[model samples]
Structure formats: C-alpha cells, structure tokens
Target: MSNNLFKDLVSSVEQAGVEVNHEALQVAKDKLAMKSIIIRVISILGSLLGLGLFIGFIALAASDIFQEAIAFILMGVLFLGGAFALNRSNDGAITVSIAVSLYIIGYAFLSYGLSNDGHLMGYSMFVIALITLFLYNNHIISFLSSLSILVAIHFIMFDLDIQTFYYIYLAIVLAATTYLFWQEQRLRTMDNLIGHRYLPIFAALFTYTLVTGIISSTQQFGYYYFSEFRGVRLFFITVLVAALLFTVHLVLDKMKVSKLPIQIATYLLVIIFNVLVAYYYPAFGIACLFILWGFMRQFKAGFAVGIATLVWAMGMFYYDLGVSLLAKSISLMIVGAMFLAIYYLIQKKGEKHDNI
Candidate 1:
C-alpha cells in the first residue's frame, strides 16, 4: 500500500478499532497502481469526451421526444437504470466517468420533464437522491445526490412560499452538518462503504452550507433582489453566523484556549465582524466561518477556500459599495485593520500552544 493509505489504515485500526487486512490492502493498492497516474487521468478525460459525443448523438436522434414530458421521464429512468447497472461493476476511472455522465443526464432529463411541476420535480429529486445514495456508492455520485436533496428541499419550500419553514430547514441542515463533521472519525471508519463515501458527503454539506451563507450575505448587501422573505433570509444568515461561532468555539477548544477573557474577546470580534459584514462586506462572515473551520480541522484545502473567499468578499465589498472612493477606502481600511488584529491574536495563541 502507498504510505498515506498505510498510515490511514493504521490510524483507523488504532483509533477506531477497525480491522485492517494488510495483504488485501497491498493487493488492492498494487492493482490500482498498475497504471501510471497520468494514464488513468487521460483515460478518464477520454471517457468524458466519448460521453459527450454520445450525449450529443442522443440529443439529435431523440429531438422529437423533447416535446413530450412522458418521453423525457421514460428516457430519464432508462438512463438512470443504465448508470446504476454500469456502476454495479464500476472499477476503473473511465467506467466511473461514464456512469456519472449518464447519471447526471438522467437527472437533467427528469428536471426538464418536470420543469412546470416544481413540486413534483422537487419530490422526485429528493426520492431519487436518497435512492441514489444507497444504490450508487461512488463518491462523486453521493456528493451530487446530497446536493440535489438540499436543492430539492429549497425548491419545494420556495414553491410553497413557506419562508419560515425554509429557514428552519436551513438551520436543521447546519446542525446536521456540524454534527457530521464533528463525528467524522466514526463515520469515516464505520464500515467499508461508509468509510469510502464519508468525505464526499461531508464535502457536499460543507459546500452547500457555505455557499448559502455567501448568497445570503450578498442578498443582505442588496446584491441579489429578493421579492419577499427578506427577514427570513436574515434569519438564515443568522443561523450561519451561529454556525461560525460554534466553529470558533471548536477552534478555541482545539487550541486549548482556556482563558475566559480571551474567548470572550474573540467572540466579541466575531460579532463586530458580523455587524460590519451585515452592512457592507458581502460573504465576509461566511469567509470567516471557512477560516475557523479550517483552523479547527487543520484542513488545508478548506483553508485555501477560506482565503479565496475572503479576497472575493473584499472585492465584492469594494465593487458593490456605492459610496465615494474615499469612503470605500476608509471602510476597507477599517475592515482590514480589524481582520489583521484578530488574525494576529489567533496566530499568537497558536504560537503559545506550539511552545507548550
């Protein structure tokens, strides 16, 4: 087995009391490494090209069926069934690539077929996503299906105009995602399939939750025009803020921050940032949420995402600010100064931990 995989196996065995079959792991890794990484990547890319061509041919051949919703539904079911069957023996990256294309195309067909019936489409998506989670164990499929479920709920609630319930749903998602990430070890080592699929699901949850925060912050800043449910959107954003604070609590605990005064001060700065972001800096609160979670988890990719989000949020703040250039500069300077001060404090705390 490769070094990282070997280490992961060791951690799983030690921390979670999971059994590791060393001989089987080595055989599996050797099989996977039979081809060079570049060849596997090229094969997947070539498969994508083939799938695209196939889709194009199907589109042209079935042009007449596009007008009939029933035809679309039938074709969608057929495609989904094909993908599921293909994935039953899905081994290579090339096979997975093709199956994934078919799966997405299946959903696209269903979406178009049920375009006019928003409620029906939402329900179908939810059911299908749940079914796909069980029937298709691929990481990409799980991630996409999880996102579909979220989008389906939002669509259903939006269609019904249940503003309050929609926000409640978002809160529930936030809570669930928080719990999932907190219990990552258990989930990732529960069993074979669960272990294989945990990361993608967590990734989907984190991504959707963070992106929602970004959009909500933008809407609050008058970037997106909401016809109604403005207050409810604010409530949703508040839930994100609460999630951020919860992540901050986790990070402080991780850093062994025991001083009550320091904790209180850190939270105070977060609140101040929240207030400022509510008024001027779009997505800043969400960016900080990313940063805190990245710190808590020591996830470098999430950290990179947080940095990118912070930069984008600042750009949006400047571009969307209607005030004079001088005013914009002043506002940005204040945000920058506060951001740096908080970062410095966090850095110092981290250094203190390392010294200990």
Candidate 2:
C-alpha cells in the first residue's frame, strides 16, 4: 500500500507537469533500504569500545596535566570539535563511526572534568547535548546526545539525593512524548536543523519513556530514591492518565470518531472509568498510551510492546492481591474478554473506515 501510495503521488506530480526521475528515486530507495540495523548496532558498540579505550588511555597517561580538571575539559572540547568537523565532511560510514566514538569520548571527558560537582556535571552535559544537536546532525550521534540529556537529568536527581522534582521530570517526559509524536510530520518536514534531528529525538523520547516506565513498575531506582514522596505517585498517575486522555482525544479527532455531542459524552465516560482504573493500576494506563500510539501510527512494534506491557502489568496487579485463585481466575477472564470485545469493535470500525 505504501509503495502504491508513493507511485500514485509521483504520478499525480507528473500529471501536474513536474519532472520526477523515478528510476533514480528507486535506486536511492533501494540503497537506503539495505539491512543497516545490524551495522548500526555494531557501530554503536564500536563507539562504546572506543570510549572505554580512551578512558583507559587517559588513566594510564600518568601525567599531572591529565589529572587537572581543565585538561579533561579541553580534551573533551577538542574531541567534540573533531566530531563536528567530521560530521560536516559528508563522509561515509567509517567517518561517521569515528565521529560517534569521538563524540562519546568527548562527553565522557566533560563528565569527568565536572565530577566534583553533580549539578555542574549534569547541567553541563545537557548543555553539551543541546550544542551537539545544532552542530552534529547524524542519526546515531543525535540519539546518543538526546539520551545523554535524559541521563543528565536523572543523574542530577539521583546523584544529588534530591527527588523533590520527580513529578516535574515526569511531566516533561510525558509532555515531550505527546508533542513529539503528535507533531512528527511537521517537524520532519521542517527546512532547518530541527527537521534533521527530529526522528532521532522522537526515537530517544520513546526509549526514555519505556525505560522509565519499567523502572517505575519494578520499584527500582525511582522507588528506592523517591520512596519518601510516595504521595507523588498519585500525581504521576493523574498526570499520566491526563496525557492518555489527551492523546485519545487527538486520535479520535483524526479517526473522526463522532459528532460533538456524542464525542463529548464518550469522553466523559472514558474519563470517569479511567480515573478509577488509573487509581488502582496506573501501569495499565501507561500501557494503553503506547497502544493508542501503536494504533494511530500502524506501529506493530509499539503495539506489541503495549500488549506485552499490558499483560505484565495486569499479571503483577493480580499477583499483588491476596485474593483466592478462583477470584483471580475469574477476574482475569473478565478483563480478557473485555479487551477482546474492544479489539473486535476497533477492527470493525477500521474496516468500515477503510471502505468509506
């Protein structure tokens, strides 16, 4: 269908007196569609290896100059400059691979230089990532830098033993996740630096969101460090549920769900029900958010993830209860049936929409 759509688009343009070299376009597409995922993974591993080697070399330098904070900062800046220059060279994979290594190593030096101060280290890394977004435009580097920003934020909160602003951080993540996916096309088509970096940022945001969701569910770092703010968990659930609802609204609008009065009534009912469900099982709501995105974008991976997350969260929820096995079995059956019914309705709606 997508191939057909592309051909139809080219045909329409040709009819409008536009010249399109489809043979050349097909060649380019074929080249781009090569199996690059494994290559990318290897490239990333190579960069990490390079970073490790650089650290080891720096440690064994055995020079007082190497021990100074300014020395590390200078080295980081130098490496970052090299990376930026390499990126601008229109080089092939080898050059970009080397640039990625240098970029990681550069940030490592910066981190070590500011190791004495947590706030300085985290904020400086964030600033460096921001600068890199404008200077280096490669996919791997952009993704790594976006991840660096998230690492910086968490490092500040966790390293400094301050969990007060966890809710604020959560809010930022949710808001960014919603906005990035919602405005994806606009950002991708932009005629500036942002367009080049949007996909990387979008991917990074989802990676961050899913990782944090796991951490939250597992009662791990977020739980250990921020347990004192247990009350704020409710705030998290509220905010997340709101995000889910807002996203649903956007999706329903696109689906042309119903007339205004009917849509408003449906929204009210959903809110009422979700409020109760979220209070007891917030992870379920989180999973539903992913499911919504999965459906909206025809994203099979995200949809699978959402379903897996849903099963895991519900299993946990049931595990936590002290109810009898019979009660649990019944409960699972009920929810499972409800989900199937909803899925059936959605499938019917999709078929109808397609026919229309």
Candidate 3:
C-alpha cells in the first residue's frame, strides 16, 4: 500500500511539472511574438524614414546644381536601377524605398521634360502613377501611386472654375472608394495574399484622402464660380453624395453582422448627423467621422488622430465665438453631461445584448 501511495505521489508531481512547463512555453511564445511584432513595426518606420531621407537628398541635389534635364534623367535611371536590383533580391523594404525614390525622380524628370507645362506634367504624373501601381508588389507603392494621381488631378483643377469638374472629381473619388471597399473584402478572402497584410495601411490612406477631399469640397474653393444659391446647392449636394458613400462603406463593413435593421438605422442616423454637422460646422464633422471610425475599428492610432482633430475643431470653433465665459462654461458642462449619459446608455444596451 505504501509503495502504491509513493507511486501515485510521483505521478502527480510529474503531471504538475508538465503543466508548469506548458505554461512557461506559452509565456515564452507570447513574448517572442510580441517582440517580433515590435521589430516589424520598427523596421517599417525605418524604411519610411530611409525613403524620406533619399527623397530629401534628391530634392537638395535637384535644387542645387543638378537642375538640368539630363541630371534629373540620370537620377531617375539610378533609382530605376536600384528598384530593379531590390526587386530581383526580393527585399520588400528596400524595394519600396527604391520605388518611392523612382516615383519622385520620375516626376521631377517629367516636370523638367515638359518644361513645367501644367497640362503635360499632370498627365505625366498620372502615367507615372499607373506604371508604378501596376509594376509594384507593395501596397505602400499602391498608396503612393494613388496619392500621386490624386495630387495630379487636384493640381489640374487648381484654376478650374467649372461645376462639372467638381462633380466629376467627386464621382471619381466615390468610384475609387467603392473599388477599395471591394478590394478589402478580397483581401480578407485571400488572407495569404502578399498585400493582404497591408489592408489596414491602405484603408488608413484611403480614409485620409476621403476626409481631406470632403473638407476641401466644403470650402467652395477654386472648383466653381458659383453664386450664393448655387454655392449652397452644390455644397449640400456634395455633402449628400459623400454621406451616401460613407453609408455604403459602413454597410460593407457590417454586412456580416446579424442585426441588419439596427445596423441600417444606426448608419442612417450617423449619416444624418454627419450631413448636419458638415453643413454647419465642417471641421467638427470631420472630427466626428474620425472618432467614429476609430471606435468602429478599435484602432488606437485612429483614436489619436481623431482626438487631435477634435481638439483642433473645438479650438477653431470657440476661438472667435462671441459667447461669454459663463455661457461657454455652462455649454461645455451640458455637453459633457450629454456625452456621459449617452455612454452609459450605450453601455447598458451592450450589456443587455450580451446577456441575451
């Protein structure tokens, strides 16, 4: 009997040892994964910084004695060669760096070759964007290409006084956004695709472009020479179109959830709010969108951006207000209370849903 008891004790000790070993192994693996993620993030930042430095160097060189067409052409060739070499070696960071360098150098050459003619330079930029978009494997390249194309279009529209150009530009942006929404779905479906991992970065860039475009449109800038009535009409029309696009994006995002009706209602309410805010206080509207996006995506970086925008909007709005200090303080208090109440109600609803 004693011998059997001694054997049982030995077995229990061995089991405990095994459990401890398993837990330790899992902890080690978690730490290693965290470290790896940190390293990758650092590497991405380093790559971006390296590309910036390279572009700065090129700019300095071009601004100095290397202002001639031949010099720009040679710079483009040098970057093209580096891109080819990096592509052959399959180095993602260096390849992306070289591609960005090539983009700027190519643009410089285009501007020089076209003698700074706006029309030709604009078209050349589009051609450059298309070429880079098609040839590059990195999503960063796609982002840069899209950005270049957008900038080129904006540059072309700089002196335009036509309502049609504004409409066309907004339409093109909506179409591009729709394409990206679908592309995001495709990326999720093919999770193993090389660009799938970069979807968040792409989404962030797309969001930035959309937000900026909407804000620019709100300003009634050089897009059109409109009378007061026409300006108001065009502004509301643009806001309405943009709100509809945002609704479409939200639908795409929440399509998998079962609460379709509730989601639809919520999205509609949000759209209505956005339109109202944008019509009155455009900066605040942009801030609201950023904050909503951050909350929906659970993205901390987005939250940071949204908070910054919110502060800016608030500062701008209150800066020139004629309200007395007491009134302003009371208004702020009321607003804070409303926010708290809303938060509490939402939390309660979430809890009820979870319980159900």
Q: Give the Cα lDDT of each candidate.
A: 0.70, 0.71, 0.53
Give the candidates in order of TM-score, highest first.
2, 1, 3
TM-score of each: 0.75, 0.75, 0.59
Model 3 residue runs over 4 Å out of place are: 1-67, 92-99, 159-183, 186-201, 204-276, 320-346, 353-356
Look at candidate 3 and give me any clashing residue pairs.
none
Candidate ordering by lDDT (highest first): 2, 1, 3
Which candidate leads the pack in lDDT? 2
Model 2, span 48-140: residue lDDT tens: 797788667867886777878998998888888988888877546667777888888888887778666655888788888887877776787
Model 2 residue 4 CA deviation (Å) reads 28
Cα shift from native, residue 30, model 3 (Å): 19
lDDT of 3 by residue, 48-164 (tens): 577668768867876864656666656656665565455445534444455555555555665555444555666767676667666655444556666777766766665353443
Which lDDT value does model 3 have at 41? 51
Clash pairs, candidate 2, are: none
Give the worst 10-residue stretch by lDDT in candidate 2: 218-227
lDDT for residue 27 in candidate 2, whole number 0-100: 45
